[model samples]
Target: MSSIYLVLDMQNDLVHAGGPNGKSPLGEQVVARDVVNKTARAIAKARDAGVPVAFVRVGFSPDYRECPKGSAVFSGAPAAGIFKLGAWGTEIHPALGKREEDALITKHRVSPFYATDLEVLLRTLGVKRIYCSGVASQAVVQATVRDAHDRDFDVVVLEDCCAGPSAEEHRNSMQSIARFCRTESSEAMRFETLI
Candidate 1:
């Protein structure tokens, strides 16, 4: 397929009701935006359309060696005990229904393409376009769009499937991202047409 649907960081720690972020403000925004449900539906539609789906997560080792020490983004992960690999926190949210044949991408950083198998997987799949959806619109969503744009891939951000810390942040991030790639709501995305 020339187009692959990339679902970034819909992990338990980030989106599930009982995970670490579940009780925080991010969780409130997620619920308010209904991003988790929309993203799950989009994932199903993509698979039914015969489009490959890649689920991307950001996690680190038990000791947090892979986590950046100085960056404001991830430095607190160690202290907070979140985003650990191979744990319930890092697992794809159950409602999303991850299939065995689907690509499972574990990323140590925010950008899925940064030093990860995502690029190689995209190349192997002959993917020329990417459909993206995920949590924290200001982070993974924006990062993937910009990186994929520079790499010459036609990228589409499924806006309703992405949530940020606040409504304002999500709106601003989506506005900025619109400059580089396309943005569509999950309901408006027609994977069958892309495939």
Candidate 2:
């Protein structure tokens, strides 16, 4: 079976410097410099192994208000300011080394598969197993794992490649995801494991 690394929304809006979603102190606490470096290393290993890498980002159109203003998420981010397409805050985190050919699956909500073409892209690539890694483990990682499992794909989550609001949150999210998917650290889940 073919394997692909679905690098989740490690966007600047969530993990990079001066990002809108990154403005929170809690976000910073979880997304330390070491975590970012480790994630980059993992991605590099995947690239070297010829495993296809896809990027998922959460962003909206040029208009800052493309997202509905009445959802629960709106209560915390009512303005949807960071979702803008071309804004620096919405760009992928610099450490990921996004390439011109990398596929991007954009969603308006927390789930990368929600209203996105991610599933289709994976199917086209004949991907039977998906390895996920990204920020906000409690939200994005959890959602993606659940969705991937429900879709009948073999899911592997790189625990060290993900973070949450706090270290405890990260740990808890990994524990929860482990119930439905395989959990491994980036160090343990190198390209060799998948290839």
Candidate 3:
């Protein structure tokens, strides 16, 4: 199957220890998991196997015009000043080793496919399967896996490369995600076999 590695929401705000929201409870989980190193290994493996790499970052405009006002999940983003475009918090974590050739899809919401160029890019690359890894398993990872399944694309979640607000939350989300996609550790993912 033609495939792409989708690195979802590994932004500094969500993963970096020194980022704007770095000290938040949610961010601590990411740091503890060493998500950046794990995700970087996954990306390197994908590149070695010739699978395209796509990055999905969640960021709203500086004015927060795209942030939903009524949604509890996003209402505080504007005030907290996290995920604002052009800000360091919105940039991908440096340890992921992003290259210029990787495709970038920026979103203002939880799901990368929602109101984003993800689908178009996937279609353009003729991707039949998506190998996903990122921070916050209960949120972006869960959302993307479900959406990809509904969209008829094969989904694979790199369990070790994903994190959540807590270890329990990550485990629970992985269990739920297994119903929609294959879940495996980064070490077990053999991209050559996938192709």
Candidate 4:
């Protein structure tokens, strides 16, 4: 079975130190976990192991037309002036070293698979197992695990590569998703083994 690394929601608004989330607890955990650097190393390892990498970003148009109204999570995007596509906040953080050949999956809502081409891309890549890592473990990471599991795809989540609103929240979310997927830290997961 082929595997792909699906890195989610590492956009500036969510993980960068200067972004809005930078002032939030999520940012604290992000920095504390050193996710950007660790994920960068992991990406390099994946590339070395010949594992394809895909990045999932949540963004909306300048007018926010693609954004869903009354979404508890995304409702504030328009008013807050964040998550606008083509904006720095929505762009993947520079530390990840995204390449043009890497698959970029853009979504409007919390779930990358929701109304997005993520599943299609997975199928196209002949990917049967997804190695997942992302921000806000309570949201996108868990959603990816659950949805991908439901779609009959094997899922492995890198615990250290993910963060949440708080440390406790991140742990709790990881525990919740453990039911649907395997969880491992970036350091312990060997990309070649998964491939």
Candidate 5:
């Protein structure tokens, strides 16, 4: 099958209402309350359809050594906290738990394709049609979709499965990305329809 569904950065650090921490400074400030539920449904649909599912997580090395010291995102991250490998925050959210065969890709940057084994894995699988879904749409979704386009993949972004810091940001990002990739609701992009 050429089609693969990539679920990006759906880790507990970013998703889940009562996740690792009672409240995420970032999530609380943005994202819809139903994001986790929405993405989970999409994942379930993909799995049920036998579509290849790839999970992407944003994490740092044990020492945060791999992280750029000056990056705004990591600049003030707690000296010792989640998002570190093996930590609860870095784990894939409970909603989209990983199975033995699911591909788990740990990304250092926003783009899952950047400096990661994603491309090689995709190539090996002969994936050509990519259904993208994830958080922080303006960043990960935008960059990854663009890169996927450049790499000559048929790309579609499932809007219902993606969440941003706010509805405005999510809407804006989806609107912008619609120019390059097919942006549709998760329901409309159901695996039954696509497969």
Candidate 6:
């Protein structure tokens, strides 16, 4: 099946050790999982296999106009002054070795497909399946996987290339997601087999 790999929310603030959210208790767990290197390797493998890649990030306007005040997940963002557009925190983590040819999508919500051009891009690219890897498996990864599945796209979760605030959360999310999508480590994906 024709496929694209999505590297989701591996932004500096969410993954890097020195970024805004990087020092948070949850960030510590993300950092400990070494998802950056794992995701980087998955990107490399996808590129080598000639699969298109898309980088998805979450960010808001400078005035925080797009941020919702009632959502607990993002309510603090405006006050915290993080994830603003053009800010270093919103940039993709440097460790991923992003390429100019890859597509970039900035989103305001958990699911990459929500209010984003991701669906259009996927359709434009004729993407039949998506390989997902990202930080906070229980959040963005889970949301995106279910949304993608609902959108009628075959979805695969690169489990090793994803992390969460805790091991249990990660494990539980993966277990639940298995009902909707296939879950595998980056090493097990074997791009050649898919082709």
Candidate 4: residue 191 lDDT (0-100): 79
Give the alpha carbon lDDT tens digit for every residue of 1-195 in model 5.
678899888888777665643365447533444667777788888888878888999888778876767877665555646578888888888867678798999988778998999999998988888998887788899998989999998898988777777778878998887767998788776663233
lDDT of 6 by residue, 50-159 (tens): 88888999999999999988998999998888889999999899989988988999999999999999999988877888888898788999999999999898898899
Better of 1 and 3 by TM-score: 1
Itemize residue pairs with steric clashes in candidate 2.
Answer: none
Q: Estimate each model's TM-score.
A: 0.97, 0.90, 0.95, 0.96, 0.90, 0.95
On the 0 to 100 scale, the lDDT of residue 21 in model 1 is 90
**TM-score of model number 2:** 0.90
Return the lDDT, model 3, position 83. Answer: 85
- Tens-place lDDT per residue, model 4, 1-195, is 289999999999999999999978889999999999999988988898899999999999999998788889988899999999988998899999999999999998788999988888888877889998989899999989999999999898999999988889998998898889998889888875344
Q: Write candidate 1's Cα lDDT for 1-195 as tens digits.
A: 999999999999999999989978889999998888898899888888888898999999999999999989999999989999878999999999998998999888889999899999998888998999898899999999999999999998999898898899999999998988998888878884344
Residues 1-195 of candidate 2 have per-residue lDDT tens digits of 278888887877777756665658546764573667877888898888888788888776675455766667533443546667888866777878888888888888888888888888888877888888887788889999999999998898888788887888888988888878998888877563343
lDDT of 3: 0.88
Clashes of 4: 0
Model 1 Cα shift for residue 137 (angstroms): 0.4
Report how far off residue 38 is in candidate 3 (Å). Answer: 0.8
Model 4: lDDT of residue 190: 83
lDDT head-to-head 3 vs 5, winner? 3
Clashing pairs in 4: none
lDDT of 3 by residue, 3-90 (tens): 9999988888888889865787677877788778889988999999989888999889999999999988889998888889999988
Which should have the higher lDDT, number 1 or number 3? Answer: 1
